[model samples]
Target: MEVSKKNKLNKIVKEIETCQACNLCKNRIKSVVSRGNENAKIILIGEAPGKLENEIGKPFVGKSGQQLNDLLSKVGFNPEQDIYFCNVVKCRPVRNNKDRKPNKQEIEACVKYLNAQIEIVKPEIIILCGNTAKKIFKINKPLKMVHGSCIDYKGIKLIPVYHPRASIIDEVKFNDLKKVKKLRG
Candidate 1:
């Protein structure tokens, strides 16, 4: 229906929760639509939900999420005030082997929701975290090779960065997150 701009956010979220738009819906415990200030200038797009996020019905709530919070704080971004967080896919793409990566079908299936979130949030800049996000945007370059650079995505400025979980394994990359604050300025 004709959801007004005021109610669009909540309405879209509710619709997503009930969405059978894709096969991912069948296994979803909850749809991780998005979180943070609706009016924020920047949106942080993650890959997908992990176990903690799925359980809490929130985006970025796991250990990686905590690291992400610290990184944001280092860059002076307060999620409640300055940033929006979402995933390219609303549900965690399942892997029977637990090591299998999310396949193209899963990514393609959920793209509509991701696009809708972007359309609704309408942020000035999008901080794309990790390879999944980069690939969705069609940037095939390695993350380390392209992180911190800004590129246009259908009129929005997209900045690619490492996923917070990556930092848990590499640690050195944590220092590079300072660049996020520059987008605020």
Candidate 2:
């Protein structure tokens, strides 16, 4: 059986630190589990580790993370104090020996970890940073069509927002900002 939050936070962190469930683990320097207060009220889930995150063994610590931080500040959310942040997969999923996307197997392998994190934090609200993040909620809805809307599932509320990477490529910065605002409200 799974242990309670207080009993398992350290255990879970240790387990994830040594996880090698999929091929991605072979290439990662470190597997990053969720990080934040043990009793965070909001959980932010993103896709997976990027180049910088993989190098640093931290999630959301790149340029995209800066944008996320700005938006969170706008909504009065302090990542270090009020929220827990994690990813759909703990390891970096690479492809073409350069780019990356979390494969089905890797995602499946990490789902248990994600579930464990949720069980520990028991956040009141979950912010899905993209489609992959939304999937963990097991909700049957088109993320694109409902990106900025909120849905309640099994007592917890989820708000799907655009991935910060989307803003890196196009003029979607405005759209992403709007989604963040909607999510906050």
Q: Where does candidate 2 stray beyond 4 Å?
A: 1-7, 168-185
Tens digits of per-residue lDDT, candidate 1, 1-185, equal: 76654487788788889978677776678888777787888888888887777767789988988878887877667767898888888876667724234678888877887887778878889888889988988999998788888888888888888887674454444544566576557
Candidate 1 weakest ten by summed lDDT: 167-176
Error of 1 at 54 (Å): 1.1
The alpha-carbon deviation from the true structure for residue 47 of candidate 2, after best TM-score superposition, in angstroms, is 0.7
Measured on C-alpha atoms, candidate 2 has an lDDT of 0.76
lDDT, residue 113, model 2? 85
Q: Write the per-residue lDDT of candidate 2 for residues 1-185, one digit (tens) a residue.
A: 86668678778768877887888878787776766666777888999988788888778888988887777776666667777889999888887667477887889988998888887788888888887888767765876677767688778878787787773443354454455445555
Model 1 residue runs over 4 Å out of place are 1-6, 97-100, 167-175
Candidate with the greatest TM-score versus the true structure: 1
